[model samples]
Target: MTDATARPVRSSPRPTGTPLRAFGALMLRDTRVLSRELLPFIVRVIMQPLLFLFVFTYLFPRMGGGNGMMMGGGSFATVLLPGLMAVAIMFTGIAAVALPLSTEFGVTREIDDRVMCPLPVYAVALEKICFSALQCIFAALLVLPLAYYIPSTPVLLHVSSWPVFVAVMILASLVSGALGLTIGASVQPRQIGLVFSIVVIPITFLGCVYYPWALLSHVRWLQIVVLANPIVYMSEGLRTALTPGMPHMPVLAVLAGLVGSLAVLGTIGVRNFLRRVIS
Candidate 1:
């Protein structure tokens, strides 16, 4: 037999762009799975933020003592609604996605199933980010009806700066997702509670969610510390975009800060996730 006839020919390499296709496939598959798991995810994302808005905005003024920020003849809901939206998005990443990721990696080994997909490991992480970001978006929307309901006065939102508000939400979601990835990969399932107690809760309180950065000017050290928190920038940016009359930081700088931090943290988290997978 002729050698050419006897031996099978090798196929040429597939296109280098195959990784992107593979990446897209992974994202689609995970999104499908995520949709099926939506109910509890929705509940978890909405619960805390709703509770806070109900108790603080609705109950506080009813009981008497909340300043004008409560909607009843107050601007309380207007100033705080955007920040609460951000907080809900942030918690979707930290509590809903991150803690579960710790369990998938440790107890159930579910991350193994994800890593087994025919794509770069980074693509798997990207899918996770996309899923978590969707939850963040959902959480943001869920807060809307509550925003109108809680304040005794009318809730007024100036949505003229939608362009910058969109930028802020995207940047905040990316940062929160990266942070979830990093913390998930680093901690064991047993230690996730500690992470929530130490890292997540502190970040939330200091993130400038309840008030504008200008309001924190009195505590110079606290202001300096919050400058390092991505949430502060996100909350302040959202306020600037959605409320022109409110005091806030520069929208451009805050957006830049959030995007920059997301890039840095996301790069590190993806690298670490890859290492964990390969190990």
Candidate 2:
């Protein structure tokens, strides 16, 4: 006999939207947030590159410091323009991913909300990387015209091959984004400032932003050591594609190194992100 007091069981309904739809919604939300902060974003994007161009490319040259002079008669502005663009890409990529990640993993705990969304954990990581890459590309584009024209020293930008140029830019952005993801995942919030001091400073100065990698041939040990830096490949790749006459790393080597970095760093970053979220 059935009991008169028996209660009915209720089952939760399954979530309706496709994973792609969820991913799109998340991306759209992020895009809106980014748009609202566009003015600050533009300031952050333009400040360092503009100053670097102003000081080294314009002020110093006008003051007779011969800032535009390089060994073998290469234009310093030409060499610097690519490196500046690389710096823009790298800095923007890293900051875009890392800063918010620090907050998300800290007091705000916003990442918890993201992880709760109907998406795979790895998809969240991929979203961060793709968004950061887009920001890096935008930063690069914005910096290019300013770097080209603002410098009192004339910059000779001769695109040897559009395909190669585009390839380098794309790869550079991906590598920087991957690097940001890895760093953001690995570092604790308290140590973020220290990471910037120790990791980022060395990367910027040693990345060959102010000079061509070929100049380092005289200092063989230094040249070999700086090769470990991803920015070397990025700067040299730009130099190779943009100003062919400048002595830069071999194109094949740059491509191979960037691809390897993307593979290793992207994997590690996603794994770390998953662990962070799950924990």
**In candidate 1, what are the lDDT values of residues 1-279, reduced to their tens digit?**
567657687998877877777777866776787789889777877787778778777777778864545322327777787788888878887764577677778856888887776777788887777777776777888888877776665667877577787878777887888888888877777889898889888888888888878878789888888888888887888778777677788877798889887988799888888887777
* lDDT to native, each model: 0.78, 0.86
**Poorly placed runs, candidate 1 (over 4 Å):** 1-8, 12-17, 65-74
How do all models score by TM-score? Answer: 0.90, 0.91
- For candidate 1, list the clashing residue pairs, or say none: 68-74, 69-76, 71-151, 71-152, 71-153, 72-152, 72-153
What lDDT, from 0 to 1, does candidate 2 have? 0.86
Residues 26-67 of candidate 2 have per-residue lDDT tens digits of 888889999999999999999998888888778878888665
Question: Under the 3 Å rule for N, CA and C atoms, how many clashes does model 2 have?
Answer: 0
RMSD of 2: 3.4
